[model samples]
Target: MTKSVGALTVRTDPTLKEVVVDGKDMSVYVFAKDTKPGVSSCDGECATQWPPVPAADAEAAKGLNQELLGSITRADGTAQLTLAGKPLYYFAKDTMPGDVKGQGVNDTWYASAPDGWKAGVKRQALGVLDHPKLGKILQDKNGRTLYLFTKDEPWR
Candidate 1:
């Protein structure tokens, strides 16, 4: 699938994907490292376990127009990508495109929706949702609405 957000062009394989960040085309996965929408949390030694969602040079990163391309400071004080104010990250084990090798891991990391180009609500939005049967909603930092994981047991 070809998904675009700001300057990011996400090319998803049957399992994995390649996304453009900081003006460079880097690989990402369908899964995310945290409950936040388009962001990640793993950094430093944590990054050693789960790699970062690569970003381009600081100047280039500023070129990204997608609202979801927000950044967060890591433990080491480096900026990391955040979606809807939440951090974004990638898994180390996913070796190939279209490979969802990190689907459901550690009960925290899982597949991410292609909401990188827009603002979205957080997973927490589902809590106050009028409809409990509606399931979990995913949002980018822009607060734009996006995908909702329907499985009750998936995120838990």
Candidate 2:
């Protein structure tokens, strides 16, 4: 019998927003320690807990960018799938398809976004607040709304 190919896709989780998942809907993750593109730092015991997604026969799902999908040779000489240059992994504790127990683990592991960013991570350092008149506005970390003074001259 011919083996079926697996696919990678994006799904919206209540806590993780949009996360990249494997063909089985299992959440995929990235390691912050993996600072280099096309390389992986997760090995040995680390690999046992967070298994790398094999590159063989893996494809991007419909509506997903196929260009972002690639592969890298691991230390063991095996092929591991990569997204936007970052290696992908499966959390051992995530027994079910939608289990994201691996998110924020040790602050080093995170669910991957479609664009290969850490899913659910705040992109900006600023915060957001609801305004009665303006509807919504950006705020500082201290809860102060930010505004620009048009009359103020630009610094030289």
TM-score of each: 0.48, 0.76
Give the Å shift of residue 79 in candidate 1. Answer: 1.4
Per-residue lDDT tens digits of candidate 2, residues 65-112? 687688899999988888767888889999988899999999999999
Q: Write the per-residue lDDT of candidate 1 for residues 75-123, one digit (tens) a residue.
A: 5655665543445555667655444455556655554444432111144
Single out the weakest 10-residue window by summed lDDT for candidate 2. Answer: 127-136
The best candidate in terms of TM-score = 2
Report the error of model 2 at residue 76, Å: 0.4
Candidate 1 weakest lDDT stretch, 10 residues: 124-133
